[model samples]
Target: MTQPVHPPKPRPGDRVAVLSPSSGLPGLLPLPFELGLARLREDFGLVPVEYPTTRRMGSSPRERARDIHAAFADPGVTAVIASIGGDDQITVLPHLDRELIRANPKPFFGYSDNTALHCYLWNTGIVSYHGGSVMVELGRPGAMAPLTADSLRAALFTSGPYELRAADRFRVVDRDWADPATFEAEPETDPGDGWLWHGPERVVEGRSWGGNLSVLSWLLMADREISQDLSAYDGGVLLLETDEELPSAEEVFRILRAMGERGLLERFDALLMGRAKTWSFDRPGDHAERARYARDQREAVLRALAVYAPDVMAVFDVDLGHTDPQLIVPYGGLVRVDGPARRITVTY
Candidate 1:
C-alpha cells in the first residue's frame, strides 16, 4: 500500500485556489457562492482565487483538469478547495495530471460527488479532506456550524491527531439562499444523540479510506479509482455515508451486500458511518418520518456488518458527509478508532 504525503499547511494570508471540479453552480447561484468566498476571506483570513472554469456551467472535463493543474502548479496557491461537489467529477479524473498534483500536494476539501477526486488523491498517495465544501457548509443559509468551523480551522492549520466529536445539535433542512432574510438567523436543530459503536473490544489504528458510499458503488461498477487488489485496504479504516438522495434501507443493505460479495467488506478493521441524511427539498419529511429513516438506515448497515464482517469495529452517526456540523475526515490519512475507549481521532 502507498503511504500518503501530507501537504504544506496554509497560513492566514496565503492564497487558496477555489475551483469547481464538478458542476459550476457558482455561476447559476451566486448567493451561496459569494457568501462562501467572503467567509474564506474574512473568517479564515485566506484569499480565494478563482479560475476560468470555477463559475462556468457545462465546463468540459479537460477545462476542469486545466484549472486543477493551474491551481496546484501555481506557487502562490497554498491550498485548493472546491466551491461545491457535483455528480460528474469522475469524468474529470482521467484528465488530471497526476505528477503535477503529486509534486505540489495541498489540502483539498470537499464531499459528496467530490468523492471522485478524494479517491483519485488516495491512489496518488496524497491525503485530502472529505468535508467542508465552500458553497455548502461555509455558505450555509444561517452561518457556518460551530463544529464545522472548528473542524475546518484545525484541518486547514494543524497537522496532528484531532479527536472527533458528535455535534451538540444538527440540522438537515436548508433555507432559501435567495432570500436575504434567511441569513439573518440560525437554522433550527435537533438535539444530537452520541455515536453508537459495535464489535470487538480492541482498538484499530491505520490510514483511512472510503467516502460517500453511493459514489464508491459507482466506482466499483466502473472498475475505476479503486485498487484491484483488495488487500491494499487491509487494516485500514473505512468511512462511509449516504447523501440527500435518501436511498431506502433496503438499497443500503443491497450495496453493502454487494461489497461483501466482492470481498470488499472484510478488508477494513473498522467502519465509520456518517449520519444518514433524512430530508430533501423535494421530499420534505416530518420529524417521525425522518427518525424512521435514520433508524432504518442504521439497521441496514448493521445487518450487512453482521453477515460479512462480524468482528469489525463499527461506529454510527458520525458527523461527516451530508449532515450539518460536519467534521472533516482525512482521506488516505491516519485514523485511530478506539472501540474500548469510545473515541475516534483522525490526522488532519
Candidate 2:
C-alpha cells in the first residue's frame, strides 16, 4: 500500500486555483460563484485564480484535465478547489496525467462528484480534502457558516490534529440557487440531535477513505483507484455520505451489500456516515417526510453493518458531505474515532 503524504499547506496570502473539474456551475450561476470568490479574498485573505474552463459549461474532459495540470504545475498556485460538482466527473479521470499531479502536490479541496479526483489523488499517494465546494459553502447567503469557515481555515492553512464537532444546528433543505434572493438571507436550520454511535465502545485511529456513497459505487464499478487487494483498506476509516438526490433506503443497502459480498466491507475499523440529505428542490417535503427519510436511511446502514461489519464502530449523522455547514474530511489522512468519550478528531 502507498503511504499518503500531506501536501504543502496554502498560506493566507497565496493564490489558490479555482478549477472546474466537474460542472461549470459558475457559468450558469454567477451570483454564488462571485460571492464565493469574494469571500476567498476578503474573509480568508487569499487570492483565487480561475482557469479557462472554470466557467465553461460544455468544456471537454481533456480541457478540465489540462486545467488541473496547469494548476498543480504552476509555482505560484498554492492550492486547487473545484467550482462545483456534476454527474460525470468520472469522465475527467482517464484524461488526467498521474505523473504531473504526483510531482506537484498541492492541497486540493472538493467533494461530491469530485470524489473521482480525491480517489485518484489517494492512489497517487497524496492526501486531498473531501469537502468544501466554493459554490455551496463559501458562497452561502448572509455569511459563511461559522463552523464551515473555521474548519476550512484549519484545513487550508494548518497541519495538525483538528477535532471534529457535531453541529448544534444544520440545514439539509436548500433554497433555489437560480433566485437572486437566495444569496440575500440565510437558509432555515433545525436543531441537531448529535452523532449516534453504534457497536462496541472503543477507540479506532486510521487513515480516512471513501466519499459520496453513490459516487463511490460508480468508482467501484469502473474499477478505478480502488486496489484489487482485499487487505489494502484494512484498519482504515471509511467515510460515506449521500448527495441531494435522496436515493431510496433500499438503494443505499444494496450498494453496501455489494461491498460486503466482495470481502471489502469488513476491512474498516470505523465508519463515519454523513447526515442524509433529505430534501431537494424537486422533492421538497414537509417536516414529517424529512424525518422519516433520515430514520430509514439510518436503519438501512445498521442492517448492512450487522451482517458485514458488526464489530466496526460507526458514527452516524456527522456534519460532512452534502449537508449545510460541512466539515472537511481528509481523504487518506489520519482520523481518530473514540467511542467511549464520543469524540472524533481529524488530522489535516
Candidate 3:
C-alpha cells in the first residue's frame, strides 16, 4: 500500500470525541478526568462529547468498539481523543471496523495502550497521533505544560513542519490520582539533560513508526498490526518510550533484540527515544536513583543498536510518550531528524 493518508486537522470550536478506547480510568479517577474535560472547553475551545462506555470501568471490548465507531461516524466530530490509556486496548482491535474508521478518517490522539489503535490505523492507511491523552496531558496538575500545549495545538489545528524542542525540565515523578491534593499543584520534576545523539552526522526524514515500547512488543507477539512485508518500514523513524510500569533495562534490550531478529530494527534510518520515566508512585526513587535508572535504560538501547542497527542515527531524551510536557508524534506522518544540526521536526 502507499503511505498512510493524513486526516484533516480539527479546528477550534469543533466537537471532539472523548472516549475510552482503552481503560475507563475516567470513571475511577474523576478528578483528573473532569479537569481534563474542562480544559478542552476553556483552554482549547473544543466541545468534548463523551460516549456511553467512556466512564464505565470494565467495559467490554465490543462496547468500546461501538463508542469508537460512533465517534468516527459522527460528521460533527472533527477528532477523537482517548480519555486515558490502559492495558486491554488491544482486545478492542478485533472489534473495530476498519472500513468505517478509514471512511471517516479523523485525527485520533493518544499513546501507551492507545498505541494499539494507532498501529491499527496505520495498517488501514490512516495517519494517527501517538500522544496527548485528555486525562494525562490536558488534565496535568497545576496547569498543562506550555510545551505540551503548543505541540498539541499544532497537531490538532495546523498542517506543516513543527520543530520539536527538547524540554528544559521534565517530570517523571507523578502524584497520586487518588488524592485530592494531586490536582492542587504540578508534579515534581527534574532538570532535563538535553538530547544525546549517537551515530554518524547526517539528516534523515521518513514516516514515523513505533510507540510505547512494551505495547509495541505485545503487538509484535500477537502478530497484529505489524507488516509482514519488512520493506514497508524501510527508512522509517522509530519512536520509543517506556511507561509508568518502568520495564527493566533487560526487558527493553530483549524487546529490541526480538525486533532485530525479525528484521524490523534494521529498517529504520533513525530512532527517537522519549525521555525515560524513571519514577512512579509505586517505586518513587530519589534524584540519584532516577538518574541511574535513566542512564541504564539509555545504555540498554545503545547496546541493542550496536548489535542490530549500528549505522542508524539515534537521539535520546526527546519529550514524548509518558514523560511530562509530552509532545504529540504524528504516527505515519513525516518526521525529520537532523543529526548534524541536533534538531528534530515533524510534519503535522
Candidate 4:
C-alpha cells in the first residue's frame, strides 16, 4: 500500500457525526456532553448528529459499528468525531466493515480508546485525527483551551502544515466532572515545563503513527490493525501518550520492550511523547509525587529508546494527549520533527 490518503475537510456549516465509538459516557455524563454539542453548533457552526448508541451506555460492539457505518455512509455527515474515549473500543473494531469505511472515507477524530479507531483508519489508507473529542476538548470546563481550539479548528476545517507549540502552562490534575462548578472554571494546572529532547539533532519528516500507549499494547496483543509488513511504518513519526489510568512506568517500558522485541520500535526515526498525566482518582499524587511519576516515566521511555531505537529522535511533553489543552495530531498524516530547531509540525 502507498501512503495514507487525506480525506476532504469539513466545512463550518457541514454536519459532523458526534458518535460514541468508544464509551457512551455522554449518556452517563450529560453535563459535558450537552455542553460539547452546544459548542459544535454555536461555536463551530457544525450540526452534531447523534446515533442511537451514542448515548446508550453498554451498547454492543455491533450496535456501535452500525452507527459508524451509518455515519460514514451518509453524505450529509461530513466528519465523524467521538463523543469521548473509553475502554474496550477494541471490541468494536472487529464489528467494523473495512470495505465500507474505506469506500466512504471521511475524517474521524479521537484518541485514547479511540486509538483503536485511529489504527483501523490508518490501515484503511484514510488519514484520521488523534484528538478533538467532544466531551474532552470541546466541552472543556470553563472554556476550551485556546491552543486546543486553534489546533482543532485547523484539523477540522483546513489543510496544511500546523506547527505545535509546547504548553506554557499545562494541567494534569483532575476534578469532579459531575460537579456543576467544574464547568465554571478551568481545571487546576501546574507550572509549565517545556519539552525535553533526546538524541542527535536532525530533521525527521514523515507520516505520523502510534497512539495511546495502552491501546497500542492491546492492539499488539490482539494482533489487530498493525501492518503485517512492519516496513510500512519505516520513517513515520511515533506518537505516544498515557491516559488518565496512569499506567506504571514499568508497564510503559514493558509495552515499548514488547515493540522492541518485535523490531517495531526501530521503524520510526522520531517520536513525540505527549505530556504524561500523572494524577488520577486512583493515584491522587501531590506536586512532588507528580514530578516523581513524570520523571520515572521519562526515564522508562529513554531506556526503551536506548535499547531499541538508539538513533531515533525524541521530544517529550508534546501537548497532544490527555491534558487541559490537547492539540490535534493527524493520524497517518505528515509530521515533521525538527530537532535542531526544537520544533514539531503536522499536516492537517
lDDT (CA) per prediction: 0.91, 0.92, 0.93, 0.92
Q: Write the per-residue lDDT of candidate 4 for residues 100-189, one digit (tens) a residue.
A: 989899999999899999999999999999999999889989888889999999999999998998878887777787999899988777
lDDT of 1 by residue, 41-157 (tens): 999999999999999999999999999999999999999999998888888988999999999999999999899999999999899999988898889876898899999999999
Stretches > 4 Å off in candidate 3? none
Off by over 4 Å in 2: none
Per-candidate TM equals 0.98, 0.99, 0.99, 0.99
lDDT of 3 by residue, 97-116 (tens): 99999899999999999999
lDDT of 1: 0.91
Position 84, candidate 1: lDDT: 90
- The worst-scoring run of ten residues by lDDT in candidate 3 lies at 185-194
List the candidate 1 regions with Cα displacement exceeding 4 Å: none
Please give the distance, in angstroms, between residue 327's alpha carbon in candidate 1 and its true position after superposition.
0.5
